[model samples]
Target: MRQLLAPALLVAGLLLSGCAGFQPLYAQPGVTRDLGAIEVTAPAGRTGYLMRQHLDDAFAKNHSVAPRYTMDLALAEARYPRGVRIDNVATRYEYVLTVTYVLKDLPSGAVARRGRVRVELTYDSADQPYASISAQQDAQDRATDEAARRIELELAAWLGTTAKVAAK
Candidate 1:
């Protein structure tokens, strides 16, 4: 049984290896460099600041360098009460963050790409006031991080494919 299992596993691995069209985005030649060349505009308010910080880290943008592309972002947030108690209290809440972004080519001022991302998170509301506030803050942080990650991935994939096409 063991001998047969080993051969079967080997065959499966070999078959899967033959499939194409799967490549790491960052491993592509110019993707990382392109991401680093972008400048993200500073956003407004506390939540916006968190989102912008995450994006800056993801893009690896250097403070000293002039950006080749400028990215402008707009953020909106909403909260909804859920799992309501009988006494007109809510036990849980849902937080939603929506971010829209535009990427522009610096030299020509042409809009290169535009997209939006939405993230949702849920958290329990504690009995204590401070605890409830803390929980809500944590949810916001999680949602902001997720939104930033999605935006980074979208931008990287766009840069990878567009760079390849432009090079051709």
Candidate 2:
């Protein structure tokens, strides 16, 4: 039984390894360059500011080079109270951020892609006012980071596939 189990496990491992062709998206040819060439334009507000900063970091935009693509972003944020106390005070809150974006080719001025991403987070409302404010700010930061990551992934995937198609 031991000999049979070892052989079966080895075979399974080899088969599974062959099935996986996983490759990092940014590592693909042209994908990283394309990401670095994108410029983001976000709406006016704190949430928009956060999203723009996060997106710039994720895209690794280069200041020296002119952007090849422009991404226009519209952001909306909403907060809802949850876990209400007996006195009608809220013990927890949910933060929801929704972003809609359009990617356009700079020279051609043509829309390349359009997508939306939503991020939701929950935070506890502390008794202290400052602590509660701090917690809410932290939640907003986390949500913005998450939204930026999602946008990066979506753009990378699109760029990777488009590069492949263009190559062929």
Give the Cα lDDT of each candidate: 0.88, 0.93
Cα deviation of 108, candidate 2, in Å:
2.2
Best by lDDT: 2
CA RMSD of all predictions: 2.0, 2.4
Please, what is the TM-score per model?
Answer: 0.89, 0.89
Q: Measured by TM-score, how close is model 1 to the native structure?
A: 0.89
Q: What is the lDDT of residue 54 in candidate 2?
A: 97
Alpha carbon lDDT at 24, candidate 1: 79
Clashes of each: 0, 0
Off by over 4 Å in 2: 1-22
